[model samples]
Target: MESPKRTRNGADVTNAAMLVDHHCHLDFPQFAEDLDGIIGRAKAAGVGTMVTISTRIRQFDRIRVIAETYKDVYCSVGTHPHNADEELDIPVEDIIRLAQHPKCVAIGEAGLDYYYQHSSAQGQAEGFRRHIRAARETGLPLEIHARDADEDTATILADEHAQGAFPAVLHCFTGGRDLAMRAVDLGLYVSFSGVVSFKKSEALRALAAELPLDRILVETDAPYLAPVPYRGKTNEPAYVVHTAAAVAEARGITLTELAAATTENFFRLYTKAQPPEELDPSLLKGAPPQ
Candidate 1:
């Protein structure tokens, strides 16, 4: 029922070619003044679906409001590593309870971020473990944010995964190939962000090229890393197309094929998110054909 959209090159991308910005922060103030315009731009670029990641569990209502307001916008629930201390007392039950909402499709933007130890390593580890437990219990994918803590992140993911299987993804992945491979070996997915589009990211691009196509996804991680050309500007979900284009080139595939694979991979992992058929018909318009 949805028509196709056009890429920057004017290629007609059907409903099936719709891209998903699997991770972003629409709740952040960077786009507060133009949130509607931002979402519209993303849709225009064929990023028909997006997930606004939660950074603090206590502020989930703000995140929830955004998701509830936008038909195609879904969210994950759990504190990010930087704010893990604030939510250290929140139990896994609460995370799982809040995630019961139809719009809450994943467990976290949680994991270790030694790059900026806003929270103690111990606290982050504890919070990360709790989130893993929540993911295991709820059957939602854990959206991990590991930075400069690959070994610890991998260890915890493997340790918990061994105890009981859970779906997970290493989001905005800029880690070494070893960590990427480790995540894949454990059946977790790796999502690239605008960073991969940087001209100096050849090493990162190499890792991306080495990944199994099905194991890859892309994001804007907006209000953060904007892809090339828009690299220094305020990032938005709309710019995810550039990141996807860069990745598609790295993988030696067309944007349409990469879009289909990543979108399918998104739905497969975030099972709580509705399939395109169940999405608002309006959002599906201009999407590539199935």
Candidate 2:
């Protein structure tokens, strides 16, 4: 379980196998100028598939366009807790309606975010419930973002799940062990982000390591939280390799094994983003030969 060496450019110099970012924000203005090049870089870095997450239902069109433009890209649709108030009128039916798109594979980057209280807690909770109902109705996975609101987040998920079961993943998980284990108890997946690679994140890494490998996934949450040695830089799908490596080492497994397990868990949860029986061999040819 030694750390995988990274080239200065962030490629896993030791591995050529593919990984999936599963979560990203390619539509953000940060990538507007070089989105294509960025996608190419991610491809070259062995990111075989990516889901550009939607943060606002009003911006679903923008998120969808990015997914539609990239063959390997898919997306989710829903409001972030910060903007939850803006789309409160939006009903479960509308969310399910929007999710019907072939490229929309999941729902809600939505959940409670007490840390940023940009929207009212009430608004966030209401929006979160609507998104949960939509996920349950649509049979699509729910992408959650719980920060400093773990108890409420867990309570809502459990309360709703009791009404009916729905697939979900605690995207970019930074919750307590109680919340994480509860999510696992409810048949949800827990995804780790670049934060797990931080030197101060030993506790997080240990918690991530202890989770069931089959119930765990990995992501970038780009363009944010770039893992070290790219710390202080804009994060992207290509940097997911760093987080993946950290997770693999924490789990006492090789990077290649973690890649296979996380990618499988991703598809099993997202369900709609089916990997081809055979990936294009050309995708294995990463980053334009550097």
lDDT of 2 by residue, 1-290 (tens): 12335833344645745788988999999999988888888877778899999999988999899999988899999999999999998877889999999999999899999998999999999999999999999999999999999999989998998899999999999889999999999999999999998989998999989999889989999999989788888888888888888898888887887887777777777778857444544432221221
| TM-scores vs. true structure, each candidate | 0.91, 0.92
Residue 242: error of model 2 in Å?
A: 0.5
Alpha-carbon runs more than 4 Å astray in model 2: 1-16, 276-290
Give the Å shift of residue 71 in candidate 1. 0.7
Indicate the worst ten consecutive residues by lDDT in candidate 1: 1-10
Which TM-score value belongs to model 1? 0.91
Cα RMSD (angstroms) for every candidate in the order listed: 4.6, 5.5
Q: Stretches of candidate 1 above 4 Å error? A: 1-16, 277-290
Candidate 1 lDDT by residue in tens digits, 1-290 = 12224433454444436789989999999889888888888887777789999999999999999999998999999999999999998989999999999999998989999998999999999999999999999999999999999899889988998899898999999888889999999899999999998989999989888899889999989999988767788888877877887788888888877877888788778777765554444432333333
Candidate closest to the true structure, highest TM-score? 2
Report the backbone clash tally of model 2. Answer: 2
lDDT, each prediction: 0.85, 0.86
